[model samples]
Target chain A: MPEITFRQAIHDALVEEMRRDSSVFLIGEDIGTYGGAFGVTAGILDEFGRDRVWETPISEETIVGSAVGAAIVGMKPIAEIMFMDFLTLVLDPLANQAAKVRYMFGGKATVPMVVRMPSGSGTGAAAHHSQSLETILMHIPGLKVVAPSTPYDAKGLLLSAIRDPNPVCFVEHKLLYKTKGEVPNGEYTIPLGVADIKREGTDLTIVTSEIMVHKSLSAAEDVSKEGISVEILDPRTLLPLDVDTITNSVMKTGRLLVVHEAVKTAGWAGEIMASVSESPAWDYLDAPMRRLTGKDVPIPYNRFLERAAVPQEEDIVREIQAIVSNQY
Target chain B: MGSNKINAAYDNEETTDARKKAAELGLTNEDLVSMYEVMVEIRHFEEMATTLYGLGKVHGTMHLSIGQEAVAAGAGFTLQDKDYLINHHRGHGHFIASGADVNKMMAEFLGKETGFCHGRGGSMHIADVTANNLGAQGIVAAQIAMAPGVGIAIKMRKTDQVALVIFGDGAANRGVFLESLNMSSIWDLPVVYLCENNHYGMSAEVGRVSGKVPFKDRAEALGIPGYFIDGNDVLAVYEFMKNAFSHARSGSGPVFVETETYRILGHSKSDRNLYRTKDEINQWKEKDPIIRFRDLLLEADIITVKQVDEIEKKMAKVIEDAVEFAENSPEPNIEDVMEWVYA
Candidate 1:
């Protein structure tokens, strides 16, 4: 095992999968000769050649469409939409065609394609470039949506998504690309629809994903000083959500708070809330489920406002304190 | 004049063999009669849908493939049970021509539970997997890119089935369609790119908007043989599609069939016929594929006028029955809203 950045883990996953299966290929804008926007597939073209690592036109729709075509023909295509904000241009093929093809064709057709998008805000990419739309993808059926918070999960999840029998939208947080964690060197897979309990607690369960999971975990450590044991649950897969893990955590803690970088209005937090509220965990609740999400507005360019727009460590700590204090 | 007669006599033999082959392939007699009825079935469905839209029975704007019936019928008839088809917004003709349950398609347009997508998908998103017709998409050229993928799957599984992708000339300019063509050609996938060059993309004429090259020529450049055909001639279309399908099934790769056709109605129900000349519209109407095919069958003595009438009556009854079935079907259960979210 070695400490690797989230970007390295993704690159390793591509390298391993491409070597393991000849059908695996990479296609995106600036991915081939130019590496990638975030450098996740940097040096892959040199390793895999131009055939496996395909440089595509600036068209986002074509990137997704070509991937879908290649994937259907038994080529495991890993398509990268440079920015998550640009995903709107190609959602028709992803949501309607790639996602639904298998089910629509009575499980006869499989779009074994992975669409990797660098998502979230940190470097002032403005409103257009920085937005978390994981919930929107989670809303679509027949799609496996993943948001990995660590280098370990990123490597394993990417491998699993590539081998998946359905289309997967792998949302890699733009801010987490350089973040490092211990990632195993050999081939490994983290099954989709499973939740990982990063830290265990009995007071309150903090359900979050992607970079927010790291924020929540850091806040959990600080919140522990005040005698509030915070349980952190990362739902790596959004679509086939780890509802059972989430419910079990909530049942043990007797309280829940969901945090995400996506906007509060109709974010994936709503689904998490609704799921827990309707589940057996409802009987164990000491307080109403709380949601600490990004403010319901475009991410402002100002550093402070952009930081305040999403959930920060302090925000998670304060929410935990409020829940434990039982204060209105 | 007597010497010209000798040359005419010599050419007649080749023409007679072509006619005979076309007849054997269900392009004549009962098959021709059935195809005409199918075209009329789609025609009446579009007209009724248009009327329904005018009366506010339908909610969204719909693109009707009214004059492009032969393209749908001809290409659709070639599809077997295992073959796949991806259609565009003007896809009701494709759906009906491919044997989609008519009433469910109508019910879907009406937003009834009896609709194909259980009323979730309206006119622009009707699909029947049982018929191997992948759903119609509202996005231009999105399905064109996807059809090649299905073709790839068929080829990978060592199946002889082909995927038929139907898009408009407007969609031909889309990057996804071009990329799909490039991939299909390189991989030698079993797919057919059927471009219905109806001369207009909503309001813009194809010649004015397109980059001054015929869509077929573009396909040819991509290493796929492009066949530009009179989409109004069902027999010619059938012959061309058969050859294309064979080439694809035999692993020779994809073919582009640019069917030169027109939309008899406006882009949608709301569109008035103000974009083009009424004379141009009448010209295409005079060459109506359904009527033209009917005449060809009658002239060849493959079918009688009365036989054609009977087929039309039977098809109308079938459509009527489908409508009744849809009307009587139940709406999807409220809990089912979250049912298909996984699996």
Candidate 2:
């Protein structure tokens, strides 16, 4: 096993897949000479040359449309938008085109492609550059949305996403790029729609993903000192969500707290909350399910305002404290 | 980030040599007659689909490539089995011209289970993977963007196969079309861009949509070899497209072509001929590619009156059989609606 950064793990996955299959290729803006806006593809161009590591024009729609076309014709294309916010330009491609091709074409076509982007708020990137838009993508019926929290998960999920027969929106947290964790050197794939239980607990279950996974785990660790056992679960893939894991966790703990970095209004946490409520876990709830997510406002550039916009470790701890205490 | 209008003008382009190029390209009497036969099949199919739409047999009106059959017949002749094709919603003409099964297409259009897409996708979403006809797209310019990607696959796989996408003039105005041209140019991908400028983008004339810059000239501005041709002349389209395909196949990069054609019918079944005069329709009808090719073949002794009559008669029967196949076919089961959604 090798300890590597989240970015390195993703880079390794791409390199391994491209080497393993010739049909797999990379397309994006500034992904070649500039090595991507975040330098995730720093040396990919040198390794694969311009053929495989294509630096496309500043055309998000075309980039995605081209990937959809390539994917339907047996080529596995991974098209990277610089930031998840820019994915707004790709809605037609994602929602209207890629998501429906397999079904609308009556099983005649399969768009096996990855629309990858850096997501979430941190580093004061302001409103337009920073956004956790997994909820928006998750609403799309045909796409598989993945948000990995650790280097190990990043590598494993990226590999699985590339191999998936359907389109995947691989959302990497911008802040997690440099975060390091243990990753196996050889091949490994963590299947999509499976949740990872980071820290098991008996008193409460905290379901989250991406950067929020770290926040939830830290909150769980802090609350453990007070003899409160908190469970931190990450549903690595969003669309084909692992409801079984979330429900089982809620049934055991009898309390559910869903957290995410997206806006609280229609965020993915609500989907998790709703799913659990509809399942057998609904009767086992000792307390009302609560969500600690980003506020319903555009992310501000001010460090303090940005911090207040999304849930932090302190915010998670405070919310969980309120849930366990059954007091204000 | 900027725009520069090119020096190319559609008005100044050379007129097509329908007869001379037919000889130069070794288009035999059989080849020319075959092109005519495909066009006849398309025309008959469109007329029948229109009747079906009128009878409420086909839901969600279909777009027809009625008078634009030359573009289909010619370009279809240029595509090899391994090459890829992306078509506009009005692509039934190209589908027939490209040698796709008429029975499957009719069944799909009629919403029958035996359709090309198992009836999930109706008239607007037909795709035949075995023929490498990727799929027909309903969106205007969005479909053109796929060619470069398919071209990328061809280039990366070290194959001589080429990819071609046919769109209307209305679609060429979109940013995706220009972006595809620019991307294809920079990468020198093996792709061909074809624009059938049928003079209207769903009633808004092409002039209003694209400010009169010939579609091919816009492609030329992107560093691709651009040509403006008579789309109604199947010989011209065939000659020009053959060059474009071989050019791309030889790794010379993409070629953008604009074929000046007309759609004699309304854009879709819902359209009435309110936007244009009947006289204008009559004039384009006079220049109808089918009649022109038929007359050319007849005069040149390439095809006899009997041969032309035989093709027309055969096309009517083919379409009639297709209609029968669709009429009796079963609809998809409700329980399997979600089947084949995700692999």
Candidate 3:
């Protein structure tokens, strides 16, 4: 096992996948020469040459669309949009073309492409660059959305996304890029749509992903003092949600709380709650299921306001504290 | 006015060059008539599709390649199965030219199970992947952006295959089209973006494009060769495409070709026929590609009037048979709605 930064894990996954499959290639703006807007693809161009590590013009639509085209023609293209905000410019290609091509073409063509982008507010990148868009991607029927909180999950999920025969949006929190974790060297992959229970508990079930998973873990520690055992379950892949695991946890704990960095309205938490409510787990609820998400406002540029926009360790602690209170 | 005014005539320098080159190709009367038959097939197919739409047999919206038969026939003739083609809504002609089964295409248009897309996709979504006609997209310039990747794929696989895409002049205005041109040129991808400029994009005229042959501007900026060809002449299209393919095969990079053509009918069935004057439509009909090519063959003694009549009769039967096949095909199974959602 290697203790590597999330950025390094992503780089390793890309390097390993590229080496394993000749059809795999990288395309994006400034991904070559400049490394990347975030340096995730730091030195791939030097290693793979200009053909594979294509440094494209500032054209998001064509970049994604071309990747879709290449993928169908027997090439696996890994396209990067510098920031999550820029992925908006490529929605048509991804939502309309890449997502629908296989179905529209009667499964005759497959778009084996991965679009990677840095997301979430942390470094004061402000409204545009820092936002969680997993909700938007999850809405698309044929797309798979993944947000990994640790270096290990990032490496494994990315490897799986690259090998999967579909379009995958590999979301990376900008703050997690430098966060280090134990990532096994060589080949490894975590199955998509599987949940990882970060810590076992009996009193409450806490479901979260991406950066929020770290916050929820910290909150769990705070609630542990009050004799309230808070279980934290991370559904790494949001689209093919692991309802069985979450439902099983809910049945034991009899309480559930969903947390995410995205805005509260129409967030992915609603879908999780809906799935839980629809399943047999609804009968096990001892307390009302609650969700703590980002406020319904654009993330601000100031460090203090940015912190206020999304949940923090303190906020998560307080929210969980209220959930466990018998009067709540 | 003294130099540039050359109407459609044999003495015109361009047509003369076309005739001379067509002569040098050493094509026999059978070859010429065979090409003529493909054009006839495309024309007949489109005509039948229009009739079926009017009869309420075909569902969803449809766009016909009525007057643009030569472009498809010529490109389809010059292209191979391994080569890729992603076309616009007016792509039924393009697919027919590429040898896509007209019966299945009609079945798809009819929303039948035996259709190219299993009826999940109607006319606008026909994709015969087996023949490598990548597919037809409903979005105007969507395929233009995506088609370049096929070229890179061919280049990566070390194959000489080229990906051909034909879009309307309206699509040329899309930002992705410019991006695609720039990217393909920079990567030297073997793609040819053929802009079918039919004078009008929907109801807007080509004069509104604001630039004189915008493809030239993009081509010059991107350093790719751009050609302006006569879309009504199949021989002219065939000749220019040959050179373009040769350039792509030589790894010279992508090419932009603007085919000056017209749509004989409204853009789609929804068109009220109120946009243009009947006289203008009648004028375009006089220079119809099928009729023009037929006359050329007759004048060159490459095909007899009787032979042309036989092709028309035979094409009518083909259209009739395709209609019957589509009408008789079964509807898709409702239980399989979730199928093909993911590969």
Q: Compute the lDDT of residue B321 as modeled in candidate 2.
A: 98
lDDT of 3 by residue, B1-343 (tens): 1221213222112443334557765555566778889999988888888888778777777787888888888788778777889888888988888888989988888889999998988889899776788898888899988977787788778988899988988888788878899889888899987888776678866665536553545666778887777889888787777778888877888887777788988887778778679998999888899888887777766778888888899999998998899889899889989997776
lDDT tens string, model 1, B218-295?
A: 888889998777788776777788889999999999998887888888887667777789998999899888887777
> Model 2: per-residue lDDT, tens digit, A86-198?
98898888887898877777888888999899998998999999998888888878899999999999999999999999999999999999999999879999999999999
Docking class of 3: medium
* iRMSD for every model: 4.4, 1.1, 0.9
- Provide the lowest-lDDT 10-residue window in model 1 chain B: B4-13
Residue-level error in angstroms, candidate 3, position A266: 0.6
Candidate 2 accuracy as lDDT? 0.88
Q: What fraction of the native interface does candidate 1 get right in terms of contacts? A: 0.25
TM-score of each: 0.76, 0.96, 0.96
User: Which model is ahead, 1 or 2, in terms of DockQ?
Assistant: 2
Runs of candidate 2 exceeding 4 Å displacement: B1-21
Collision count of model 2? 0
Give the least accurate 10-residue stretch of model 2 chain A, judged by summed lDDT. A96-105
Q: Model 2: which docking level applies?
A: medium
Candidate 1 CAPRI assessment class? incorrect
| Model 1 per-residue lDDT at B26 | 52
